[model samples]
Target chain A: MSDLTEGPSGRRRGRPPRTESAGTRDRILSAAREEFSERGYEKTSVRGIAKAAGVDSALVHHYFGTKEQVFAAAIEVAFAPALNASEVIEHGPLDGVGERLTRFVLGVWENPTTRTPLLAIVRSAVNNDTAAAVFRRLIASQLLRRITARLDLPDAELRVELAAAQLVGCAMLRYVIKVEPLASEDVERIIARVAPVVQGHLTGP
Target chain B: MSDLTEGPSGRRRGRPPRTESAGTRDRILSAAREEFSERGYEKTSVRGIAKAAGVDSALVHHYFGTKEQVFAAAIEVAFAPALNASEVIEHGPLDGVGERLTRFVLGVWENPTTRTPLLAIVRSAVNNDTAAAVFRRLIASQLLRRITARLDLPDAELRVELAAAQLVGCAMLRYVIKVEPLASEDVERIIARVAPVVQGHLTGP
Candidate 1:
């Protein structure tokens, strides 16, 4: 752990280095996600993110140019993992696609890490036009279109809408809207009941 | 039509009569609905509804008491028509219940009058807990439970939730979230594509 041992590429380091800088950026992003989720977009400030990340406000500003940019980055971080439904549809048997899709989507919301950013997005999308567009693109447009393209059925697009509606509606009721009975029902029970209905949307009789 | 004809019920017309008060109340309710629809709950006020109705703010309070009361009345007014789905389920064949239910619900949305207040409720429900509760009781509890009870299916309650998810999700996309493709697609196309899915929820394999 000497100065000479620190120079792997024979370049002297003045400060932490490139990898450390990237880590700092990630920390800032994580903090931004938390701040935005906890307080929403308008109420959260760059200073708050920096404070949470244990960095100066200027550093947060430098890492993420603006609040909107931070939001886009946070959304990407949140949704990119759950947006893999296209693959399940592309390779899996058509019959089980609904169950697979239902499990994947509900699983995302059930997890705290992913759900936090999504909650922030859904909450803001209620009143903010830009947020709504961001959400629509992330959900209905980006992820859903991929699944629909792979399906072979009459009015496949509309069928996919119906399928999406079932899941999204359940999510709204359970999470955002918080309707009773459905909201309190166990997750496995819900999946068992709803998965088939979603499948009906996919391969109709 | 003058005072000479007052012998009918011993009722003489003075200002505009009792019927005029009822008409004025309807006007205020209509105005409140419009204001709440255009601007969300927090943004709307009794003054705004009164202005929209072309009546004094005092009259709005006199009729509806408070903004909360106005919202409750507006929600009841909006949902009363669409709440007929239970009766359809009660009297009609169990198999065709899906088509009848889907058609009735979508038809209500197609009409501008019903859709306005519904759109307002859905939009507000996204972030506002009060609005969400009101919507839940109206659509999920008041209407769908009756159909669920008659189904005699296992997990009947969950089935109802699943059915509600499909319709509510589609409605959210079409009128509230305004997702593309599905939002712009014709109503009959939606019901045709979705009714089977709803039926599947009710009577699953």
Candidate 2:
């Protein structure tokens, strides 16, 4: 993926050439996430992100074109693991799709490293219209559409959304809302109880 | 009830008594809802709500003691219809509880009058910890506990939460995130597909 990191070098607009473009990009993304988390969407600015990343505003703009684009990229990287969930559904037997999908999605939330950024994204989306639009677009295009394609049913999109709703709600309660039992319950136990329901939504009659 | 409206009369310290006490309280609640919706949880103040209500800040405190109390009161009023959902489960046969519960909860969301305040409460909860705590406490005590009590299962609370997660997640997608076709799908159609999964969470073994 060095080419992916080095791809920006061609558009040199009097900027310094460095071998650490990938590192700089990652630094910018990490700063962006922190800025979004601490300041929220409406209050967070690209300049603020650059300051946090210890990079120039020009570098921030060079990598991610706009504020929404930066937010989208941050979300893309954070959700990269869970986005692989389409594969979990695709590769598995149709009958086992629910359990596999549920386990995989919840597993992503269960991990602290991924959960932090996901929390920031969900909170931002919940609070800001611009963030919500960006989030809706990305989720529909990246995650839901892939799942819909795999199902191959006329109402496959609806089915995928229903399944997604089930998992997303569970995560909200267990993590964001911190409601008891579910919040404090073991992940495996929750999986056992919720997997069947997810399966029913996805593949059941 | 008049008793509820007039309940504050006894504790009235130097406040003028009027027959329009209930009207005043309702007006305050209405204004509180608007303020919370506009300013969000953190920035919203009791003084701001009182200004919106055209009442004294002391009156806002008299009706609802703290900012959290004001928010709690608003939530109570907004969710009054939803809190009645326990009766939907309690007054029905056990076998059809899922459909009844799902339809009832989603129906609350379906109403614009109620949905507006609910949208405010949910957005606040997702974005603010104080709001989330108030939400969690009220939902568990007023709604989930009642459902758990009716179920009479050892794991009834967890079951209730799982069912809640399913519906809450669905609402987040359909209403909050506005992810389509789930966002635009017919409520009845969604109810038809999702009730069973809710049922599976609540009553299925």
Candidate 3:
């Protein structure tokens, strides 16, 4: 029943083909990222992604099921580095967690390989509600929940959100909108300037 | 020459009709907002806006010139309240500037009438470079520059961007993405929580 819902390509009962390997899956995901980035969520399609990945459309459906599922997978991979950076909160002394987290997350954005997919997913999420829901789910369950767990207060969730807001907004301006000065400014200098405020959100009175 | 460059319809204008009252101009602008909001900047056209306004496409071109110009006019009206709110930084002592600015900006988001167009413009800005350039120009000149002028430091512009980033990020999470806790929380509560961080960005050492 679930496979039926996963779409027609997944309905086969036999063992998967040798061609349906991990590398192929990564190739499809990479292609999906480029498609979503260039065309956005509404305009991108399974067929389009498959064409870009040099594979059959059925292969894409076999792997990622629907476009929403494909987007979620793409987002998960793109966001993995930043998601892992949530550990900075759990590992460090509480005091500098803000700077550590800020530096690590911004570092992911600074690297072109990571930033490309991240930009694609963010652009997709902002422009389409379905994409936003997928993004919200991953961020909440994977990233925000982890950071929230590390905070001891009852209002810790809200606190984590405010801190997230600070970083996310900076990224939106610096990367997505490409607003001047902020867009061109040095990353280290931005981290230095932004870290304290993030710390204040998490641990300040 | 300028009007010719404005687009084809602007070339025929000598004196606009008596029917082209300020009310008609306003109606066209309002319809443009709706079109941009529903279709985003990339998909929205001056003809679509004119159709929505119950006016001829030529009239829309005559009044607003190009699609970009129409978008700018719509944005100016939608953003006027927030632009006016920038005065808050100047009217009071600098100590609570963060809270005032945060409250005003959030208040704009909290109101549905203003938020609709804001969401459209932001979504458009994120999706298309041309729309983004238009948004960046207005925000940098009309909004950021105003806030920058009020600051006493040499890095006042960067400082303002950081502060803006904090609030902008918060707005993105709360309003655009509709992330919970931040999204559904009381506006006053968010203000209390975020003002200090914004304050720190602007004035903290």
Candidate 4:
């Protein structure tokens, strides 16, 4: 067999163009995460991130248009796995929806990858109006709406929203503010304790 | 009988001191509230607050020291009147405690005087780490601790903290983010709906 490869124009060529572009994009995103996590959203500039990534500033712009978009991307990466929450909800018995929901949320917060970026987004939101607006939209659209849509009840919207209020509030106290006891408590213990109340909010009359 | 009066301080000096210093302090507090509410903590400078009150900047400093101190004082003014929350737990029928607690909390959030400064604090805390620290301390020491202490249950502390989480989270969604249904619903209806859950968390097994 003869060695052959495809190129931009269908003939054998150098390294694939798509892979190179993807690599550059990935490098920029990786650098953006580090910059954001280290210096926060406001302090980290595009040039600074590009410099750290060893890429031209214009290339950074070419990939992610603005600082906000960069931030949104970073947040998306952090929160991407979180979207799999639908499966958790879907597979669980509906009657114990509250317990399942609480466990899943607690698990996400307890996970290091989700926790760090979540804290970053929350901290930034606390300090910036623009950031808060973005954060709110992200939560509403990505998390709450999906969960609410999956609910199978008349007042599912209200129930889902209330359940959200409960989970978010718990996370705020436990993870963000690090309120004692709750923060240090075992995950199973917390899930066991809080599940019923959460379930009540979701499935109760 | 010569129609003469002795000053309490014994030397009737310079306009009799007017007990107006207290009035001036109140005026400064009012002005600080306006400033904090309108411009937020970081943007509202001491001079701006003093100017709003028609007083010299030095007077504001003399009355409240730093801007943080002014914020503390302003918060105290807004929250002091309402901190008698003990009465809600103590005087109300134990069975109705949840309803009462919810009503009281919602009432405070609905009030313009209380709500405006609170929104400012939330906004500042989201943006400034120092402000967040101060806010955390305020909530932990003044609000959470006090409310928790008033409860005499076995798990009073945990329950109270959870209750605080629920109340704070609801406020964050309804008042600060202005989420629908919650924002537009009748205050009594919300209280009736939410109080039992809070009450159950506090007193249930």
Candidate 5:
């Protein structure tokens, strides 16, 4: 889920240097997210994504190389905003880190547009091993570790995961499972209640 | 999952008057749990479960009626113990309820034998809509509501799900996803840290 400022578009291979390549790549990722979310990892085929993107299946294979690569790219793109928060929290006050982290994480899930791809990645990862691996690598390395590394406290990693557990557990119930009340509760109201515990985990005695 | 005292074995119907009916029923459920956990809802079939159980596929249908029913039974057996915690929490002091609830929940995941079936149900429910529905109903109604009903307070249900969100979220990361230090940290240490937050969620201002 790292944004990889190295620029994914710059790394394209075997394509004529046309301006539309980026457009096509973005379109493929968009289609893949939708199809993967709707049909899931096992059922979502490269051809299906291509068909949805209005491109040849071969073009998808050409751009992303494999379904797994496509999924990885989609996740990175979707989580780009949330990934930025890691940097924000890195420089923020230690005391405010929990609030910053909780707000940012839940904020991602709160946005309808972003929530689609985020939920797609989450649902796919929760069930599919490959997707789960992708998710684990991104969250553990890119997101969680980066945030924990900035905390000079003992069990920093454990604290980070506990904070993540609260946010993610809330997201799973509210977004994925759509459990009542929690699902329909006011976004800010839920955040107010959860942020303190997250803060406690981050900076408490 | 709380092992239901209602005795899933005694609930078997339409079988001939065989004394070993309980044993046979248990065998079928055991096989169904393994197969369903391995293959999930779509791929798992009654015939496959029967094969694993060393019985005729007809016997599986006779015992459980359908694949859905077989899965339902398997979940009931796995979650029965965790489910029973609802009653235990129901009578505990409102203030101590949070610790009691968190202890009981994490305790379930800590047990190796129970963790297998519980993990299967969690992973399956995350992906399959049908499985998620079944899980949502069981957790929300059986566990969350029963605990909330004891509170005698407004938004008691909301508080219950939030508490659940914390515990279930931690379980998903610590056990199901096995996400780093949280996964490997001392169980008691985690329970100590997490129980307070769960307590706060359950009984806080």
Candidate 6:
């Protein structure tokens, strides 16, 4: 009975199962990022990603319910490290939250691994409304709201939002647009110049 | 024959003629603004826009070739007033460029006519790569380059880029994100506060 149930598949499948191995999931996500970045969201497909990841289509569907969910997961993974930025604010003096935020953001853009995904997101956003909506929701819910919630100031929400705008606009110029000296400057140098402005917005009266 | 070639059914056509009236185009664009704002780029189709505009499907296609071109035209119209921002910069004292720039930008956003499309573009930028690319190209070619080209300072590019970053960052918060009192405060008051900061980036020693 056990042998018959198992068959020769070497798998316990009714509907293929809900969870997948972390390694397999990561592999799919990485491949999906490359595809989405290279082809944009509209051109990318589950079959293409599955082929790139060397996984069965059913397995891909099992892990991620939809293409949008897959893209979301890929972005979440790419941004996972940077998302913990709140911890940096939490650990540091509240007075220097702005500077810390600036440094942290600049640092993320400075690293190629993280910067590429961000650039991909920004580039795709202009023509792809679905991608843009997801990006906006992610930024609003995860980055802006989360950061603002940590601040204890009177206009904390406004200040955090302002800081985010500054950071995102700067990133647009420096990374996505490759605007001159800003694009070429050393990371620490930028942090030195912009940190005070960010700090002021974060904690200034 | 003359009658057949005259009136609404005129047959003297080389390009099939523009079936959409100028008013229809404007009406379609107005509906586009609302659709793009509410449903975003991907979900909003020409059919949807035409239905909203009370026009035929062919008329919509006749006026706007593709969704991308429609967006481009919309943006061009939205930013039409600011195309000659060089005039403002040229007239101002070099030392006060930042203030003028800041004030000019804030004023534009404070106005309802300009603010709606601007918000739509900014909000949609996150999900659409082509839109972001187009937006970046437009800013770089039409706005930033022209602004920076007139400057004689050694690091004029960096200065111009930073000043833009600041102004745009501020606007992103005050308008798109709706951060207050920056969001609700009088435009002139905010300009008075932010202009010097922008000026320092532009013309300050």
Best by lDDT: 2
RMSD each, Å = 7.9, 4.7, 4.6, 7.8, 6.3, 7.9
lDDT-best of 2 and 3 = 2
Residue-by-residue lDDT tens digits, candidate 4, B1-205: 1111322334322223456566666777899888876776678899999888877876676666788888877766666645655568777677777887778877888988777666676666655556556666666676667666666677676777677667777887777655555667777766766898888888888
Fraction of reference contacts reproduced per prediction?
0.71, 0.85, 0.72, 0.33, 0.67, 0.34
lDDT by residue (B39-99, candidate 1, tens digit) is 7776889999988988887666666667877787787777787777788777778898788
Clashing residue pairs in candidate 3 are none
Residue runs of model 6 more than 4 Å from their true location after superposition: A1-20, A186-189, B1-80, B92-100, B106-154, B170-197, B203-205
* Superposed Cα deviation of residue A182, candidate 3 (Å): 2.0
lDDT of 2 by residue, A68-172 (tens): 989988888877887899899989689999899989989889899888888888989988888999999988889888888888877888888888888999999
Q: i-RMS values of the candidates, in order?
A: 2.3, 0.9, 1.0, 2.6, 1.5, 4.5
Using TM-score as the measure, name the better of candidate 1 and candidate 2.
2
DockQ of 5: 0.54
User: What DockQ score does model 3 reach against the true complex?
Assistant: 0.70
lDDT of 5 by residue, A1-205 (tens): 1222223446664343456567777888889888887977778899999999988887787777888888777787777877876786798688887777788888888888878777777767767878777777788768877887787788888988898889889998888777888889998888788888888998898
Q: Over the stretch A1-205, how does candidate 1's per-residue lDDT look in tens digits?
A: 1222322333332233566566777787889878877776667888888889888776655555676766766776776767776776778788898899899889888888777677777676666666667677767767667877898676777777777788888998888777767888899988988888788878766
CAPRI classification of candidate 5:
medium
Report the C-alpha displacement of residue A98, candidate 2, in angstroms: 1.7
Error of 1 at B193 (Å): 2.3
TM-score of chain B of each: 0.75, 0.88, 0.86, 0.79, 0.84, 0.76
Q: Taking the tens digit of each residue's C-alpha lDDT, what string does model 3 give over B1-205?
A: 2322333343333234444255677788889988888989889988899889888887787877799888888888877877876698888989899899999899899889888778888888988888888888888888778888888777888888898999899999998888887888989899998888788888888
Candidates' lDDT values, in order? 0.74, 0.84, 0.82, 0.71, 0.79, 0.69
Clashing pairs in 1: none
lDDT ranking, high to low:
2, 3, 5, 1, 4, 6
